[model samples]
Target: MNIGATVVFSVLFLLVTVLGFVAAGWRRGNLDELAEWGLGGRQFGTIVTWFLLGGDLFTAFTVVAIPALAFGAGAVGMFAIPFCIITFPFIFIVFPRLWRVAKQRGYVTVADFVHARYRSKTLALAIAVTGILALMPYIALQLVGLEVAIGALGFDTSGLTGDMPLAVAFAILAAYTYKSGLRAPAMIAIVKDILIYVTVIAAAIIIPGQLGGFEHIFAAIPASKRLLRPPTASGLADYGAYVSIALGSAVATVLYPHAATALLSSKSGNTVRRNMVLLPIYTLLLGFITLLGYMAVAANVRGMPEFAKYFAAYGNNFAVPALFLHFFPSWLAGLAFAAIGIGALVPAAIMSIAAANLYTRNVHLAIVNPRMTALDETRVSKLVAVFVKIGAIAIIFGLPVSYATDLQLLGGIWIIQTLPTVVFGLFGRTFDPRALLIGLFSGLACGTWMVAQQHFKTSVYTLHFDGYAIPLYAAMWALLLNMIVAGALSVPAWMRGAASFTGLSGSGDSLRDEA
Candidate 1:
């Protein structure tokens, strides 16, 4: 066991645990009110919101999985850099409007806005279900990241004994989150971001130097893995896959419940907009993080006997951890690992809370108990948050890490289907909720089938159009079908003079006007 690393990791982890609990008092609000507990009273300023959104979006999974993808698949993993860059402009434009409507209407989840806008409880329920379902694998991926960090410190992450450390860590996380709610993650995010920036910046400077240089790192990669494949007369399959993944992911990034939760916690629309401009700094960090994969390739860590078992066991997910362990001293390695593990807690906590908000507001309050009080809603959300984390833990134990990654891709596919309803619904009231619901289900079914055709192994599916073939993200294809169906159905309603059904004229100002 690496005693020095373990000790440092434990110490840093304990510090965060203490901070998580104390955060209940940091913002100082009534813990029993749903707004106070779930949305941090919508009071986070530019700096706090910046860290919260960063911690929420750039997760531990990104640290592990992106680099792992780079290590194994070459330049395709770099799709995340462009994906992130594309996301901020969307955020700068859309979320400020969303925040305005949600704030005015007291909407807690996207489902809440969908319900209020369309006045369809069933449609809102569908949105809630999709958000929760999409988040399950996402939260599980965070645990996978934490497990990798813990394993790097020489823990016996096998059988029952392996599950114990994860269980204990989550138990502490759940306790603090239940007591503090959004404030917990909002406060802890500051520290998590600091550690992540330090770790990434240090690695960017130190690792390449140790492994000869950037030139050597690039030279060491096999020719096949050096760049994306060029398009041919047969099709632009590779280019399509690359561009579609970037575009699809950018659209899907802020649609997750966790992302919504973080954005809604901001003090105002301006805060969300300011962060959008500043958040791309993280994209730069992601670029460095992706390079770790190439660094691992340059160092040939997978070929080393010491890391062979880790590669066999965790696959590419261990690339960053193994890279740190091989190059850095034990204390520094421990600090980096702690950054990853703590990174997991921040997002996992926020995601669980987000899912709970969806369930409590859109599902339980709307269906189970219409008369439920704010206190009752807060209580139920806190309890649901705990259960959500438990469900995520079950996923980690129940499925292999690769399955978790694949399921997260499927999550993106599933969540993006909500775009027409949530994002488009914000601009104007043209959609019939029934039509949107149908489009949502259609997209879900189509995307699932497409991914299933690949045996759940890849998210990109190729289409044959006569003699030409094009591969693209299944999510994008599904989203296209969703928009077409929703638009087609709406046109019929508009022609029939069923203005109410079409949401054509009077329902309240569009969210854009409110913004």
Candidate 2:
């Protein structure tokens, strides 16, 4: 490990930590309010919203997983790039309506909106629990990426435990967030974007030259890697799994608690609308990162399909940094390492805060103590935010973990389950509350089973993606069944002219008044 580069990155990482604390002051006074700490006082303008959304979408998962895909599969990895394009139209058409309804009713979490829409706190609470459970692995994944990056930068990671680094990182994050609230991560996103662009563009330019250009590198990739495209020698075949994963990710991205956290924090519906347009460009950056995997191969940069394995070989999850270490000079690799390290912090901090808020608002305040004062809610939320950081730190000790391998399947399913509560409710549609609960149960069962079938191996059981041996992520299929069941059951009530379904509750304001 180069001592100079490691020293530079350590300094930069510390600087970011300090900057996080400063962000506490971005909006002064009364962070003790749940509305303020959890949602940045719901005051973020268009530019801040853009950065927050972009940062949330392009997380540590993108940093590690994209190149991991490219390293393992080749051209199939670009599915994420295209999926973003498809998802943009979905967000543009759907989210503005979501923002409008949420703003009108002062709804903070998706669960809040759902309960209002269908008059079922039970249904709303279930979705809330699933979201937090799903997001926790994701937050852990970011710390895994940071660990990889720091290790590769040549830090003395000899004594780091499975949970130690994550705990430290989370503690720092919790401090700033507790002090500054959502504004801390929101403010740091600017620096995060700057680092990402620098590393991505720098790697793109430098790596291709060292690799004998795209033409040379394309020839080297195996036929199995590209089901179609130029390099497949025998015939043109489509990479279905690659495409599915990409589209699945885009859909999953919107469903996350943090994605909603970022959106709900914005000051107006227009800000959310503007962000949908701007967020796609981050997908472009992701496209650039996916390409770096091929460049790494061209440079003979050693990286493994699994994040921990890759870190073992190269000591970091930063694909570009590893590539720089092998292909570029020592000094340049250090700078690239800085970008990757900074990149990890931006999204991880935001995600943990988002998850913390979910626990505090949707679960704690809503269920545990509904009559609690706003000041008390804020204090508990801040404290929970700290605990969330500490929890993340604990997970970090279990480093070299396959974050995507663990997270993608589960997170995808969890986020999609929110569609009914967040997306369907916006249009004033109510599925039968009982039916919705049944659908949620069915979806959870089917999705979890499908995922088990796709990947896990046991003496008695094995998961297979149909017959192909490829694991088709089950989130999409599970969600399909969930919505189908919800709708089909709902149709019965309309046809029978049931009294229960007729006087369906108005949005929460009316429902709360009734209660």
Candidate 3:
């Protein structure tokens, strides 16, 4: 083992653990209430909200994967840059409304809003199931990132023995998260964001200086790997997958329950928007990080036989970690590893809590126990959070890292199915709840089937129409089918009038008034 790096990493991780426990009382409130424990008493201001949501947005999977993608595939991997760019505009336009509606209705989860809007426990349950299912793999991706970082620390990474360190790390994360609730991640995110910025900035300056310059780095990358457009059999550039994947990811980014959990914890709608305006600063940082991929290429990291084999076997997920070990001193590399681990832990804690909140509100309380008290609800959420962490660890140890990548890709496609109902729902309830249900299910089913048919290799599939192969994203097609089904069915429902619908409990004005 790289003892210096490992020791530094342990100390940093231990400090974060201590912070997590103390954060239970950071913004102390009634721990018995789900609103307090699950959502930080809904009291986070601009700065805290910025760090929390920023840390949640730029996760370990992102830190590790973006450069890994660039290292492996060239420009296509940089889709993350545009993905982050487009996301803020979308969030700014959409999330304030969601925040308003959610705050108005005392909704704790997105599923809660679905229940209030549709008045159908079944529909809300569907949303809850999708969120939970998508999140498990999502959280598993974080663990995979953590594992990769740990391996970079020169530890043994073979079989169950390799997973021992990860299990211990997550156990600490789960314990503190259970004690401090959202505040745990909220507090640690500060440290996480700080470490990430410092590490990336250091890498940005140091790596290129060590590798010559940008010109040399760009020139060194192979031509085929330079752009995002993939080549067809005829060697023509195909942009379908690149465009679709970027768009789909942008749409799906905020749909995750954790994103909603972080957003709802803000003090107000304006606080949510203001934080978003500043959130793009991380996108710039992300742009710098993606360069590590090209840097990895220019530095000829693959020239090392073992590192080359590892890259070939596991994909580019390890590029950043490998680069850190290759360039930095042992201690600094350990700090990088700790940063990645903390980055993963913060989001992992948030996601587990969000999934648990969904279960507690939409499943446990809505179906299992309508009379469950606030204190009981908080307790159930905490327990469910621990259970969710266990499931994520199980996924990590059970699946190969490559499969974890596939699952996260599939997750983006799956979660986007909710956008039609949730995002469109914010504008107006013109679309009938029944139509929304049909659309959501149709989109979800079609998207999943299309993605599965591709064997999880790519997000886009081509259809032979007449003589030409028309390429499209599974998400795009699924979304099209969704809108068609929804639009077709909703007309009759709209003609029948929203008032005739039992689920139409209130108008937009009424919802806003409740705020």
Candidate 4:
């Protein structure tokens, strides 16, 4: 870590800290209730919402992981680019209706809407727990990315024999977040996004020229190493896997609670529509970043133990910074490093907020004390926000990089399983509450078992399925099973006078006969 880089990062850190405090005033009035504190007073306009959500979506994990995948395995990382690009259209189509219904019914979290519609606290709670459980590991992964970036570019790895550095960084992030709420992250995002775009876009242009070009870099790899695992020899990645990952990721992307919160925090349906159109340009930037991996390989930046090691000697988070430092002036490299570092802060803060909200509303308020007041919810949420930050710090310390990345992917699969309820319940007429529960459980089980089966390397859950290697990413498949079961159950349910879920008279809240 050079003094130039250190000073650059430090100055940006101070700037973000100031932004956090000032953003607290962005709301229309004082943020007294939990909703305002947690959701930016439900009044974020086009600008704040665009930057805030972008800051959240273009996360640290994406920064490190995407290029690593491409560098580690060619052509595969492109999946992330398309997946991100395609997701906005999906969001535009589905979430506007979701937002409309939520606004009409005054719903906050997706679980709130699910519970009211399905009339099943059990089902809603299951979905909520999956989301929070899945998200914590993802948040932890972001810390890992930040650690890599800092160690590579800023921190001297000597004398730091443990997780102490990561723990300290997370404590700082948590402290500011607790003081100011979502407003802190939103303000910081403005700077974070700007720095990231400048750095990544600059790298995309400069690195290729430094390494001759993409064709030259890719030509260095041996033909055999490009093939898949033993018992079969194919391209390192197949078309099926590529398409599956891309499509699956696109669908799964919008289903994430944090992602949804980012979308809902927007000002209006039109804002979401407009943002969706412009969001793909970021995907083009990601595609550029993914090329850095091959560029590193061609630049002879690899063949070292643990990709991060090779990325070090200068900076471990080198997908972007390495390229910048390699080809640009020293001061410009330092500026690029600063942007990625600041980028970590913005989303890490929001993720910490989203996790805290889940714990407060879905788990704590629902289970511990159903009768809690608005002020009580606010207090409880702040406390939980503090603890979630602590948990994120712990994750940074405790988990391995490889394991952490796997968990984040598994989180996507798990969170995506809740989609039918969220996407379907908005307008589906025959979907009875009881039927939805049975389907949800069945799908969840099937998906969990599937993920376990496929994740032979790092995951914990697995089951054999028709002579195929499958583990992790069962959320969609499991939910498909859940839907089938729910449909079957609804028939008998209807025959047996299961309380009609539709055509309610009075207030739309009085599903009294089910009692």
Best model per TM-score: 1
Best of the two (2, 3) by lDDT: 3
lDDT of 1 by residue, 366-409 (tens): 88999998889999999999999999898888777778878888
Per-residue lDDT for 256-362 in model 3, tens only?
99999999999899998898789989989999989999998898887777586556655678788878888888888888999999999999999999999999999
**Cα lDDT of model 4 overall?**
0.70
Could you tell which candidate, 1 or 3, scores higher by TM-score? 1
RMSD of 4: 4.8
Clashing pairs for model 1 are: none
| Candidate 2, superposed: residue stretches over 4 Å from native | 156-166, 228-239, 303-319, 398-400, 457-472, 496-515
lDDT, candidate 4, 1-515, per-residue tens: 56776677778877887777777676655565776777776677778878887888888767777777776666655678778867888888988777766667666677887877778788778778877887887777777667666765546543446456666666777777776788888888888888888877777677767777777777865554344333323222254455556776777768777777777666577877887878777777777777776676676655444445535542334555455555767666767766766677777787777776777778877899999988888788878877877777666556556566667767766766677677887766466677776677676667666666666242223234565443323554565677788788778767656445554554345767644
**So what's the TM-score on candidate 1?**
0.96
Evaluate residue 42 in candidate 3 and report its C-alpha lDDT on the 0 to 100 scale: 88
Local lDDT at 264 for model 2: 86
Q: What is the lDDT of candidate 3?
A: 0.86
Best by lDDT: 1
lDDT (10s digit) by residue, model 2, range 1-515? 67777776767768778888887777665677777777888889989888777677776557777787687668777777788888877878777777777788877777777778887778778888888777777777776667667667655454645335545666676677778878887888877777778778877887788778888877777766754443133322244345556666777778788888888898887787787778778877878888877776665655344334445654324555567667666666666676666666667666767777677667887689988777877787777767766665555454435544455456667677667656777776667777888888888888777667645321011234434333334666677788899999999876765544445564666556654
| Candidates ranked, most accurate by lDDT first | 1, 3, 2, 4
Q: What is the lDDT of candidate 2?
A: 0.70
